[model samples]
Target: MDVLTAIRGRRSIRSFKGDEIEPEKIEVLKDALVWAPSAGNLQSRFFYFVYNDDVKRRLVGAALGQGFILEAPLVVVGCADIRRIAVRYRERGVYLYCIEDLACSIQNMMLAAYSEGLGSVWVGAFHENEVAGILEMPENHRPLAIVPVGYPDEDPVPPERVAHKDTVKEVF
Candidate 1:
């Protein structure tokens, strides 16, 4: 699917089919992240693919029983390696800017998934520290978001958006 079509088709799928998502497709989704524009080309984002059932359950627990996480066959975690940023800006460390970079990359991956006829949901309501520890990430790497991917079993309509007149701002 084209960019605009994917953008309009992508939805926060809460129900997934029992079929398994192929690793090749998962790689395709991840490759989008590698090409995502990063801040100063730091390339500090790290992705973790969680396919194990037990681990998925742990993640759901960390997410306070958001069962859909465990239901999906694959979970992609978007993380930012803060230590890399700290190398150049020592005092500043990873900072919020790095988080934004990772988050944007995750969104790119989500869009890629949609183009491939897959469904994904961006999960931000979760325990970050617990996820970092579960993923065996270093102290400087922070978990930004979790995206569950698969063939959606249910089709829920996207909610209507506010008119552009109310949302767009002009600062002249």
Candidate 2:
């Protein structure tokens, strides 16, 4: 599918079927993430693909009982490698660039997943520290997004959006 079509058709799927994702498609998702443009090429992002049921349950708890996390066949936890970027960019890197890098990678993965006939949701309302602890993340890495992926169980309609005139600005 075209890029615009993928962007317009992709939905924040919360319900999922029990089918497992194909290994090649999972590889495509991973490739999409690593190939995303990073701040200064620091590539200060990390991910954990969780397939264990026990870990998914713990993640659900960390995500404030978003039980759909456990239902999905895969859960990808996106993290920012702060120290990697901070070595050169320092404070700004720690505060912003690392996050931007992770965000870009996550967006790439989500779009790739959609194009591969999978569904996912970007879940950010979670306990960060708890997620770090649960995943045994290193000190330099910080969890930023929790994405659950699988075949969609429900087909939701497109959500409302503000008009470009209301949100966009033209500045010369």
Candidate 3:
């Protein structure tokens, strides 16, 4: 699918089919993340690809109760190594930019999933420390989002978009 079509068609899919996702499609999503723009190209993002049923269950049980997480064969936990970014960009005010860069990487991954005919959702309302413990991430790594990817089982109607006249503004 084209970029614009993917962007418009993509939705936060919370339900997934039992079918497993192919390894090649997972690779495509990861490759897209690698190409995501990073602050100063530091590439502070790190991904923990979880496929084990037990670990995925733990993740679903603790941080997220979303059963789709367990149904999906692949769940990618996005993490940001702030210490690495801090080392490279010690200058003040750069930490926020590094975080923004991490967000960009996640967005790219989501869009790529949509383009590949897969479904995923950006899950942020979860316990970070619990997820870190489940994933066994280092102290310096911050869990940003949980993306459960698989074939869509349910279709969600598109939510209304904000009108340009009310949301956009121009200042000459």
Candidate 4:
């Protein structure tokens, strides 16, 4: 599918079927993450693909009982490696660039999942410290997003968006 079509059609899917994602499709998602443009090309991001039921349950708790997390076949925990980016850019890198890098990678993964006939939701309402502890993340890695992926069980309507005239501005 075309990029615009993918961008327009993709929805935040919360419900999912029980089917396992194909290995090839998972590889595509992985590729999408690594290939995303990074700040300073430091690639200050890491991800954990969780399939274990026990781990998913723990994540659900960390996510404030977002039960759908346990329903999806895979959960991807996106993290920003602060130490990696801070080596050169210092405080700004730690607080901003690393986050931007991780956000780009997470967006790429979501788009790739949609292109591969999978569904996912970018969940950010979780307890970050709890998630980090649950995943046994390194001190330098900070969890940012929790994405649950699988075949969609429900078709969500397109959410409304702000009109360009209202949300965008031209300074020049």
Q: Model 4, poorest ten-residue lDDT window?
A: 1-10
lDDT for each residue of candidate 4 in 1-172, tens digit (9 for 90 to 100)? 8889889989999999999999999999999999999988999999999999999999999999999999999999999999999999999999999999999999999999999999999999999999999999999999999999999999998999999999889898
Query: Model 4 scores what on Cα lDDT?
Result: 0.95
lDDT of each: 0.85, 0.96, 0.85, 0.95
What TM-score does each of the candidates earn? Answer: 0.93, 0.98, 0.93, 0.98
Give one digit per residue, the lDDT tens place, for model 2 in 133-163: 9999999989999999999999999999999
Candidate 2 ranges beyond 4 A from true positions = none
Pairing residues by index, what is the TM-score of model 3? 0.93
lDDT of 3 by residue, 1-172 (tens): 7889998999999888888888899899989889999877888879999999999898887665877788887898998877778886774424586678778988999999988888899878788999999988898888888899899888899999999989989889
Model 1 weakest 10-residue run by lDDT: 88-97
What C-alpha lDDT, on a 0 to 100 scale, does residue 102 get in candidate 1?
A: 89
Which order, best to worst by lDDT? 2, 4, 3, 1
Candidate 1 on 88-161: residue-level lDDT in tens? 75545477657767877888888998888788999999999999988888887789888889988888899798
RMSD of each: 1.6, 0.6, 1.6, 0.7
- Where does candidate 4 stray beyond 4 Å? none
- What ranges in model 1 sit over 4 Å off? 89-93
